[model samples]
Target: MKESILLVEDDSSIAIVITAALEAEGLHVDRCDSIAGRDCLLASKPYGLMLTDVMLTDGDGIETLPPVRAAFPRMQVIILSAQNTLDTAVRASDTGAFEYFPKPFDLEELVRTVRQALGALDGSDLPDAAEDLGQGLPLVGRSAAMQAVYRMITRVLRNDLTVLILGESGTGKELVAEAIHQLGNRRDGPFVAVNTAAIPHELIESELFGHEKGAFTGAVARQIGKFEQAARGTLFLDEIGDMPLEAQTRLLRALQSGRIRRVGGTEEIALNCRIIAATNRDLVPMIAAGTFREDLYYRLAVVPIELPPLRERADDVEALSRHFLARAAAEGLPRRQLSAAGAALLARQPWRGNVRELRNFIFRLALLARDDVVDDATIEPLLASDNAAQRAGEPEAGIGNAAPADFATALDAFLIQARPEPGTLYDSALAAFERPLFLHALAQTGGNQLRAAQLLGINRNTLRKRLVDLGIAPEDALGGR
Candidate 1:
């Protein structure tokens, strides 16, 4: 005799597909379209496992699970739903569902999950109901790409595992952190967020660890650091990849010991909060460059949640546009509705800056749209003009049409990522500026050191030494290394 499973889904088409998939896997299946019907089927015979949807014709699938749990404590349950919201995911987790699959889930994956649930009921670890907290985070998306992120958020809600959110700039990494903090066990505690990049390198330690009065030239009074302020709460570290190496050492020590001491204080304080870190930069290259600490990366990545960039999840663009439109109207901006054409147009954009850029554009459109509706025709001109204005605001590349280098832009970028000891800023900035200039001269001279030297208006020996100092290969040629 084959093992039997119960599937409770309202849609006949979905029920048929699921039943067929399971039956193809060599399982006997009983299906129902209502909660009452599900109960009727369950009472008729013991099921090897149950697959349920949150909504049913007769009653709520998840709400009615308590009775099922009481009647069949050992049977595992998997939730499938079309609601496709974070709230649904959490609710399913609260019922200790083996897994939550939002609609349009991969059938093969679902079949695999069913096999696993039936095969290891006792050994499997379910997300405990102890983490039933947090109003569903205000993340708006039904994209399949976002389902993984939603699942990750629900898992960490039951524990204090440190989370690291990674994504491109404006991809809502901070929002993911907020969701974990807001939905996790420590929801009631304060959620203190600090951008590690915004603080000066000299004062970053003092900001995070707090400093004693008279501890340094500017220390006049003792103050509480973010860690102490966020006790019994969550301390979010944004732009964590940019933290100074020295500060990373201190932070690692604090995380390891679960305690901290003020810069000059004698008393050590115990940590009572959770840690969540996020960064947009790719830490792998930084690790290779010796700019980021490998040990610290491992510590912060206990529950890493990588958010998909807006471009990767373009299917959500329409929903996100409307979501932002609703907010803009609620904030007193003119109300506007998105048309299918407008949404299609928006989705076609590269969205290079990710969600943040899209959100900004939507707000501007809501305020500027002459019609209550936005379509390709209406948004197209605005886009061109908006892009034009942005270009106008940008610093010119050079005076020539031959495309000379943009040193001003380059310098600004360098300063942003510049890490240099005081009084050495000149040397640091100089080297960065000279390397490209030297490389260009070398390329211009066709591998001849003397000619390259003359082209650079410097002595041959001096140019040779500078090339070695800057580590520029003398063999470099155009269009090749």
Candidate 2:
């Protein structure tokens, strides 16, 4: 049972750093960008701690505190601000703030405070810190890569930190942003998502900063941008890598000053919204190539999270396949189970499109398979199409000198030439191949089963069985005599 935290902050950079640190400590965090968002989160679920900022887009945090305390007496509240005045601290404390910290505060101290707060709540309630990423949304997999990400999300939720999610397209970058928002202090706030790449270059600024009535030819009425709509909540900037250089500068200014001037409006409105930016492109390379701003990259990547591609976490395929199939069935599609050969086939393929593609494939497979079980016959054709696409994209080195670019293609060719029929030779050969692979992996990790399991993306128990099936005794796996 992870302790839940609520974080209310407007700075993207700060939110990222703080969230990363707190999550690393194994606490569950939720974020709210404004007072309204905070209120909504409070109304939905009870949190162990409430960390809020002094100023917000809609209203001040001090004004929001009393209502929150009145509603939930057990909830601990803390105020974070750039204002370091003695008056502000004393007033906030008097108004029921557990503590007040100035900007650039030590994140370690914040974690300590959170632990103490949780400890004070109930002696028996402190959960085992080592439990793998506790249950939450569609984000599954207990792989070390995912565990690290989960930890980062936990810490940042305890404080207002900006988050930069770096991953390839279809790897669920937006899902990560939603998780941060849903699990953080502002779970009740609106999760407004904006794709910077999708917006026209000319209208990017107006779309972000809102537009006044009659501001442009098509402006029949005043229109609020994502920033305002996400006030007291989260603003997810998807495809942020494609934001123009000019827009980046304006964004930097807004992040720094916490102010936004609407298009054709002189009034500079203060903003308090948590910012989560996701991009498939590598900002570092872009910065080096002079396309992306280096400063903005640093600003957004305070708590950078890199999501691994599906191929990299192949161990998760069977689990994810079953999960997707269940979801499809729930949605009125036929329920399907993967045959042993089908699961093996899925494991061999390189899912270039990552989780999203895998999910779509599962749904399609479920719909197509006449029987309850989806076997290799149903999987091979689809896998071949993906393999063909990959080979077409890759440059051929030579005739026989270069290997097949796609693993599925190579596997298909090997199985056909070897002529291993389904139940006997084919199954035996695969099990033989998989066993040694698992044993060798364990050996490489020096018998650290947990690490080996994570590296292989399978549970430890599964790895243990592979060692036994391969007849590689535990001593051999441990590199013993």
Candidate 3:
């Protein structure tokens, strides 16, 4: 007996192709152009599976799925959409779809998914629609690399699995964590983020697991740690690779036992939060070097998602450049539109700093560009200046890369936006320059103050004093390493 399948797609061409492929596999594929036609067919006939596109003639295919699922509880669903953003992916997952295939997906893979859908057509629980996922969708790009990431994210949206995101700095790891939290089952609870590497080795435990009054020199009262504060929610541990060995032991214990005790308290408070960890460092090498824990790595990386660096996805640069330009305008920067040549030129750069560097470049372009529509003429001068600065010693897009004219423009903008107190302008300006400078030095030395001092060609005592004066902790800057 051939199994029946319902495919509700508005595009006649795509429908023909899918129907031909499925019919060849000895399956009966019923095609429809709208949700109303789908309902009429489903009411008259039973189907082993249903494959639908996101957009139809009458209404959104995904939005109307809940009612269809209610009436035909046993039929499985697979969604196909041209909308490739993370929001659309999450929305598809919210409807409890058996699988989701973004446009330009592999036809073989789609056929395989259809076969799998029919083989296991049990009544799976339909997840409640996600509420208020927010307007801010940070993760962008529709490259095949990004599609892989989106699929991994959807797999974890309905569970509390510990997710470990791996990528170079500025590859939007935090944004990935934010998406999982906002789209996952625990969306109603708070999302608490703690950068473990930013806390001093001596204080990491107290910061994450709380501390009773007088537990340490600076413990003035019973403070809630990130673990407890994130109760029934999610805890995002950024830069997990930089956590000290001593703190890593304590973290492993908590994960193993599902409980935590304050630094000086007796009662073991049960942990009740989903943990999402991210680090740019390659942990396999770190594990062999006896820095990151292998056992703890296993626990954290139950489902590791490696984000593609910008160099690999240069195709997405134009889209990302325009996205950043729009955001810059919304944030009160001059409204600028990227030209075709301008986007092409951007796509050719190595983008050593990944998306973070590209975003910074776009914002600067929005600020300094001469014309409303920026072409290569507008972008070339800026790139030339930045390249000259890079050759002169600074990393790509560093503070020291600014020319005298560029420096003046930045200072003028700062003056306008900061509105510094008349008497404190010099002090404030000096502080602003020194903060990134010191942080850059500390980062190059891997948090070793002695080395950072040497790197900056300054006395260790001077470096220490300046770090304190500027409130720049070695841990804070060293996280990027």
Candidate 4:
């Protein structure tokens, strides 16, 4: 006889489709709608495999896993849910679910997963004990993304493993490192942070491993490095991608041998500190390009934790905004609360700078808004001003015959020196130079597009077209003025 499969799904349409699919595969399929109904079914017969949804009519599908596991330890369980958050994936993994399928899943993939589960019916892959990540930690956000990060952090706290945190700039890579140090067994030990990118390339080795007096022409006095300072503690290397390859070799050696030789020093110092490295850049690409060392990358990335960009975690925006606003108020900025519309406005923003950008914007709102409650209207002008300032600072390829090279030529040279393949250079340069110029001209003329056109030496119709193309409303220019 074919093995039996139990499917617990609330949606009748989904159940019909899944049942048909499973039955077509020559397996006996049972269907139910809730955890209670599942318990009833489980009590009656043995199921070779179980597929369940997270939200059921009577109770959560996740709550049914324990009892199902307890009664049928070797039975394979697959969790299907509409909730596609990082937290949900982590929770499913913790609960020993064979597979997790987000809503709108591919039927072929589901069938494949089911077949694999049926072929490998065993409990050996599940954890002996599920780790308990304590509630209300320093990291905010109950978003699925944040929950996954929390789970990974808690897993590494008990061990002295080197952790590599990857994320875009300003996404709190440093904060994650700090949390690891604070929560880990090394809580009492000193937590030292060093920005590898900020330090001078020539002096980085001396800075990390210390130097004896008269080691070099500039080394007049004996100085202890970051490693010695962070003895029996945690050393956080921030922006580690920017470290020179020579320094990476030294770092890799130190990590391998658990010892470091100071500059011009004969004896090797024994090192006993946990290392946590963070970077916004993708090191794999750098490794391929020969800019970063592969061995060093492996050594640092033993336990990798990637932070989600702020835009990806939209559910947490309001909470993070409020947190920043409250902090600004406590620091003597005018007390303020975000209006519902303002909160929604924050949630909708792209937030290219991530959490740091959001925090700074909140600080600006608290400082600028006169009323206790900040609204969407109050935020618009400030955003315009901030955007205008950023645009104004961008390199402008102004038309000038005084120099031998034209604007584009100069830009090409600059781009070559910065990096060879500066993608979308022409359009970015044009937009950057045009925005502030047009906005400022319009603001000076009281939002008069015609007058702004005259001042900018462009046609009025052309100015109008540019404004429309740039998504700049006339009201923003007026408000900014």
Ranking by TM-score, best first?
1, 3, 4, 2
Q: How high is each candidate's TM-score?
A: 0.83, 0.56, 0.79, 0.62
lDDT of 1 by residue, 16-76 (tens): 9999999998899998899889889888899878899888888878878877876777788
lDDT at residue 365 of model 1 (Cα atoms): 97
Q: Name the runs in model 3 displaced over 4 angstroms.
A: 121-123, 126-134, 394-481
Q: Rate the local accuracy (lDDT) of all candidates.
A: 0.84, 0.75, 0.86, 0.81
lDDT of 2 at 386: 64
Candidate 1 achieves a global lDDT of: 0.84
Which ten residues in a row are the worst by lDDT in model 1?
Answer: 396-405
* Model 3 alpha-carbon miss at residue 191, Å: 1.6
How close is each model in CA RMSD to the real structure?
A: 6.2, 20.9, 12.8, 10.7
Clashing pairs in 4: 87-144
State the lDDT at 334 in candidate 4. 90
Candidate 3 residue-wise lDDT, 98-182, digit = tens: 8889998899999998888888847365474533352577888988899889989989988999999999889999999989998
